[model samples]
Target: MRQGGIVGPFPSARERLGNGAISQSANDWEHRYRRTVIMSDTVATALVVGGIGNFFGARDAANWHEKWGILAFCTELLVLGALAVSRSWAPAVLGQGADEFRRLGRALFTATVVLALGGIALTSRNIKLWIFVAIPAIALVTMTARYLLRLRLHRQRKAGQCLRPVLAAGSPATVRDLINRTRKFPHLGWRVDAVCTTDGLGLDEDQLDGVPVVGRLADVAGHVRRDGYRVVAVTSDPYWSPHRLQRLAWNLEGSDAEMIVAPVLMEVAGPRLHVDAVLGIPLLRVSMPTFTGGRRAIKGVVDWMGAAILLLLFAPLMVSVALLVLMDSRGGAFYRQRRVGKKGREFTILKFRTMAAGAHGARGELAGRNEGAGLLFKLRRDPRVTRVGAVLRRYSIDELPQLFNVLTGSMSLVGPRPPLPEESAAYGPDIRRRLLVKPGLTGLWQISGRSDLPWEEAVRLDLRYVEDWSLALDAVILWKTLRAVLHGQGAY
Candidate 1:
């Protein structure tokens, strides 16, 4: 097939194949990156374990090796062994999402358990020190190191390095969506260099959103083999039958390309998805979202405890904001609105008043000037906003009072955005999934772009959160919330 007409500034298929430069870059960097991570993990584990041993075994200078040296050596080995067993160093998970940290955490937990068991078997008192202090400290250090490494890798990706060349095969629409997403999130490390549609056609004859449409659906494996594409992304299309997909997989065996099939259930991911082989056929099984269980119980406890701590920490700031609100407008210092919570339960949500006394009454007048998305009613420069209210809203200081709701079990620190009664009432069956868990003080919507996101995008993010909710995801959202608030990009 012709390799011309590739759009954008990216290298075309012919250019890429000419020097075989980009083709080998993925493998080269992946190998180097994996080695770096292994070294980082080893050095970090050794340092933490060695430091702990020295601090505790210093009492017996001459016998320190016999006493703490053996235990420390064993601890280090166990930690490394756990990491290897857990696939924490897997290249596929290195620089994106919560999976890398989650695997590291699992490794640490495994190491801790093994250490405890070994301690019991050997009757050693130092095991408690390792389990209680050393392991936790190691976790902190290693996770921080990994996060730093990810930041560096993200920077490199943004600069157009360390990327895998993707060969996308699907309908034109799906291919276009894939192109847009890869361009939008370059940090994910995918670059769609070529495309293959049903009849070797794209939306624009030869190019689909700047990516060259090189071949027909049947030509996918051929292009992958000839051009050395690193990833073969098979998006949803009628052309790919089970037998065809199996053949494609078979064809991919000798090549380094990883085959990724996009399931129809794209919105649901993370731990909720499992692949089970039944009767020699691989079946994609989706587990139901958990609303009640040990994890939910833990989430509740974390909400209450976190809210209590935040309230205590922000007490003075909250009081000062209340005083400012009272002085700024002819209204009470706090605003109370009935919002829909988990299970469609109604609860009074509180915030430091950021509008005039009768702001709700006047909302009708500004209906045409509405800038909010979907069911939300907002105005970028609403006349009802007091000076103090504007500042509060800009920095998200107005939401401080929601901590009290979290403490009271009416909300969580991380979940879907709580909707008003009218909004909840208007929710269709699918959208109503947001009410399955308690609302959150901050969520995917808050950290993503706040009120600036499009209506569909906002709902998609909220639904994504509900479908892929995990404690690790919650922690990631919370960490990102700080940066989002500081930027104040989408706040009204």
Candidate 2:
């Protein structure tokens, strides 16, 4: 079963160790852990299918024969079984990133395809009605259930529950960085319980980055067995050659501990990464950044259409905001500031004016009191903002006028933040990448802490969005923007 010291292909400890007692304990715990996720999904699927079936069955008694009802029940069970086989309830992805949602979507698509083929084989016209009802009902109900479960997982993690104990193995610096990141985002659910260094370098100090140093790299396997650590995370370290990692992975196998290697690549989204096997070597492949194509064209159309619809819906509110702006200050209802747009095109960004008529002129005098990131200027209690302006800025009501700019193609519904001319002038070559696409009314920065982000973080997010533009990602950002505005976490 061994291939150059790599762990066997099977994930089960019993297959590797042949120790009935130890493997049985691991299996039981894993079973119980997986049960919660599986049961939740199972209940959601049953409710959606049963509810839809009963409703439609009552509506048309002639169509809902006993045989047809039995067929519907069997079809629902088959789809549920398919979802289970796809590992939609896998514990590794349950409370984590977008993988859970992605898996759910893939499973649903598979179910649809299977049902379509089955309907064709059976020559049944009623299957069309079932497909239409089941797809939306299953998708809505299952996604809602998973989101609620994720919220519970996050709450539990905050209270220090449902986290796997991790033993970090690497150099002190990488281990420290990994530990800090784990602490900062506890919802990812890895708690660094101990550390093991290359040569026990920091063991004398007893701790590194708040995690206790237990042993040298050679003692990692012994520590896992002794302390019952569930995960061993190996980050970048000179001592961890391929052979060394393979040997480590082998030793940890069937010990109730899983080994995970964290690549040094940072902040790259999952969509951009793939693993390629070439000549028995595992290589990480990063896809080329996409900037132009059919999708981009579709995005442009969506931007214009969505902006027009929103403007129509919010016209009354926009008018109310304009009146408030005029009553609170002696300025025009609308303000236009020169901003750098796509490919360095300068545009006059529109907004309901939130400051006095001469506030721009007074910006120079308050430069010394600037509180914003990099070249940006901000103040918690600016003298320029009118009383009404504060409320608008807090809830982002002032930015509604930008829908016109979106319609005009000067901005997008979701993209990087539109920079001021001054900010763009100071941008380095790397930062200029943000100008690759049209600037946005809202973007990653808006949903991810907004004005509270540091200059470097804000720039990074903008560049990331520019490099990895997808309509799906845009939809996610727009959805999050609503939550962000409601919470008012970092708004001015």
Candidate 3:
């Protein structure tokens, strides 16, 4: 839901099936789902308000409708207009990034502000109820609808449908990296149909990483037009000077292809990027990372409140798990181990014991069976795991007690995973960057692949989280974590 939105509607038969495919016939063949998505959102807002009113009482619903129908209609349109003004419907944002959700949030806030100003202008005092109910309902329902639609789009992309062919124009290394990354995450909907290099140095092989070399940089415009490529990505290539790139962009005018320049700064997130024009030249500006101040304080408050609430809601489940652990093994129900936390402090991390009382004593004997990375030790079929423990670990039920860690400020609900002391000792400089933030009960590594992730990849994801941390990113991770837990993909 964070990325990808309804591009317009489904393409016509000629665009999809016939020889006159949109790729072949039109240069402006980007997904045009803004109209459909926006219209449906508006309708959804109206329906939700009406449905809420009817749910309260039919007579009341009718009475309210009669009294406020026109005003309500205007309000809905205003919200939609705010979204459009925010460029939430821009083609580039479709099906990509937290910016879409961020813009949606801005639109909702603008709606609220607009309503407040309008009520003052009219000197009305009765609009409070309408504002309180309608705005939230509209935001929730519309966002939910958009999320569901995004899920559908992801399914289609996974099945290789709705993908726009891309012609990668860059050096061989960067081009291969882009292809690999796009292939790895097909939800991005970029299919490297062909590759175009700077000077066609590797054209003798006609391919790099299995993507055919269509042409050189000079031949990009022709290949894009002839082959109907929807994307022409120019990644960090020195050969394409700024003027040369500008000319290429001009050449692509009115064509179906959209030209994108992949800057060298790939690690930065959208929220941190801005464009500044100085004397007619556009420069990409990157903001410094925010790890302190008001936002961090807000994160701390959310972690404490969220942990307390989750503990209350899951009390019954936690008690049941505790009882099961005690009955299944002749040991304490709860386990505590010293783990490193934020600022390299030690904390007693808590969990539901899933092994025998003396399981730690057997570590030396089973060292030969270790299957983990670096200083870590993991065994898929470890002998020490009790019957109840196996079940607990599978869906991560054992980690439930970490809520206390989060509540006590030793952990966060979302951050990098905490490493053991020995593991911390083995860390190189890059890996040590993870210690800058409080470790989390769940994080990118948790939702991604958990124990199945390779050591290098896990460190990379953790560092990525460290660099681009945001509340929206955390929300996305938590949502994905729920799905991962339900599916139990990589849990041991």
What are the Cα lDDT values of the candidates?
0.87, 0.79, 0.80
Give candidate 1 misplaced runs (Cα > 4 Å).
1-14, 17-20, 61-66
TM-score, one value per model: 0.93, 0.85, 0.89
RMSD of each: 4.1, 6.9, 4.2
- For residues 306-413, what per-residue lDDT tens digits would candidate 2 score against the true structure? 999999999999999898889888979999999999999999999988888899999999999999998789998899998998888998988999999999999999
> For model 3, how does the per-residue alpha-carbon lDDT over 1-492 read when each residue is reduced to its tens digit?
113443322242223454325474222324344555677687897896666545532343333433465556667778878988988777676665666677888888898898888777776554575578878888888877777767776776776556777889999989989989998998887888788887675535887887778678989988776656788999878888989899999999978788988878667765777889989999988888777989899999999999999999999999999999988979889999999988789899999998888999999999998998656799999899999999999999999999999999999999998988988888888788899999998999988898888888888899889889888788778867888998887788
Give the CA lDDT, 0 to 100, for residue 332 in model 1: 92
Per lDDT, the best of the predicted structures is 1
lDDT (tens digit, per residue) of candidate 1 on 64-103: 3337888888899999999999999999999899998889
Q: Using TM-score as the measure, what is the rank order of every candidate, best first?
A: 1, 3, 2
RMSD of candidate 2 to the truth, in angstroms, is 6.9
